[model samples]
Target: MTYYVAREGSKLWKRVLGETKVELQLLGEKWKLLLVGVILQYIHGLAARGVHYLHRPGPILQDVGFILLPELGKERAYISETVFSFMFFSFVLWTFHPFIYQSKRFYTVLLWRRVLAFLVASQFLRIITFYSTQLPGPNYHCREGSKLARLPRPDNILEVLLLNFPRGVIYGCGDLIFSSHMIFTLVFVLTYQKYGSRRFIKQVAWLIAIIQSLLIIASRKHYTVDVVVAWYTVNLIVFFVDKKLPEMPDRSTGTSPPLLPISAKDKDSKSKEEQLKLLNGNSLDTSDRRPRTQVNGKHLEDSNPVNGDATMNGT
Candidate 1:
């Protein structure tokens, strides 16, 4: 898949993406890794809900509601709670979009590991750092005379797990310190930038995120502080995840580390020497780069595993 590497500029995302004809493929298919990701998301959701309810049946904090973001507001967009639904609907769609499109397949094993790790860490952090505050919103007015007089009754982890569907999906008012929509937006936006695509597509991906976050404020689903904090938190996570989980290489190779950590050049000359030593049963130098060997010497002469048959020089 093509990935757009942004040029050096203030608006990095606006830089055009070009393909160098190098199609990167991971070592073999990672169907099982993708499957594990699906399962982990389910577990993460379960755990998030489990911990979310632990601090519930508590006091309401509507102090964050007074700071009006009227400029970003859409009049009556949430008149009957439609915008919130659309926000949620779009979020759900975006969650699975890359998977279906295959243009930016989230199928890489390294990517899957990073995503699962992010979910685990974020959820754990959210669970431990419970801030009992409510930012004013359409479905989240915790005042006494409001439709929802107080926050919903807290449910046990098992009960929440069993109750499922709409009930499980809904979040309470006090859990609005940070917005998941913001975090999710960053995830997809960075993913678009990483997977090699047009600059326009990348911009649109991030634009949607910004609009959604603004709408969250307009619709009163979150405070400005919520969105701000989420942006910072998710961005930090993105940096670490990218640094730790480097992209995988060609799919034909098995699941082994590359000879050079970040070097595209194979160090073929060096590998060739190692291959010859292995063939002759020489004790190798202490290095992690053990050369690839022919399985049974049943392959072609060109398949000498490194520099073809040229190394069998005087034979």
Candidate 2:
């Protein structure tokens, strides 16, 4: 008799991964880290090309249970194709936005390093799981609403290269356990919050992530479980990366200390003139540092309820 793993297996599996210690001493030293980061772009390009050439097509396992997602596969191959194409490029292009704009330099650099680590780890896991599960990928079938969805069938090496993975050169087999689309999507969501400005752009980035995830599932291109796994996997990656090394903060843009009512100690220790000076933008004590806001005349103290009389009257 054959045995299938219970749903409880998911928790058991995660527990094992959590207990596993991951150590990379290569990045332990500051000098080595600096050198690699300086040339990360070139390294990434080489790695992508390496992965592209290494992929070998083989027979993937198939099962009827999760062959096609009902919600996604409308069989209108055109819609599926269009959504896939759009998401593929959208994900790829967004990865470069942070570097191109150079908004939050440290966050961008940290994100790039973490992403590279995640990619290498994910690719390794995919290979192991592919053999272990022996599950056929959803890419092998395209069905939507009881109709056959027309889809591209790239048979040869050249065709596979031409129709590569959305974010990079990796190609999907019949049943990859996780979705690559979501990985890139979630990565952007993290980097953008730290680096991205303008509320409109941030909102649009989130919208695209939502649509891409749903689109992939609805089109029956990836199993529902695959999408879920991708979400969890990204979380795990983020956690591990941050646990080892905290996210690098940009020193040039130090946060301004918020204006607070003078403490009892401050009032006792300093003169009235010193207290007033501190309350305003200028530094009162020894430091030459100035407040974030440039005060031409009227100070930000006008907006504060700590104005003493203003708070007492409740005006």
| Candidate 2: segments with Cα more than 4 A from true spot | 1-110, 140-171, 251-315
Q: On residues 1-315, what C-alpha lDDT tens digit does candidate 2 reach at each position?
A: 123465556555664343221112223423355455545534443433333333333343353334554554446535745655665565456544433332433332344565555554554454444445534344533222212222244466554444444533333343345666676566656556555556887787678776776667665556677778777787677667657765555523656332235668877776777767777646755665533422344445435425544655787
Worst 10 residues of 2 by lDDT: 142-151
Q: How does each model score on TM-score?
A: 0.53, 0.45
How far residue 303's Cα lies from its native spot in candidate 1, in Å, is 28
Query: Model 1, range 191-242, lDDT digits (tens) per residue?
Result: 5567534787677767777777766776665567777878878778777867
Q: Rate the local accuracy (lDDT) of all candidates.
A: 0.53, 0.51
Best lDDT goes to which candidate? Answer: 1
Candidate 2 to native Cα RMSD, angstroms: 19.9
Clashing residue pairs in candidate 2 (N, C-alpha, C atoms within 3 angstroms) = 61-136, 72-218, 72-219, 73-144, 74-144, 75-144, 136-174, 137-174, 137-175
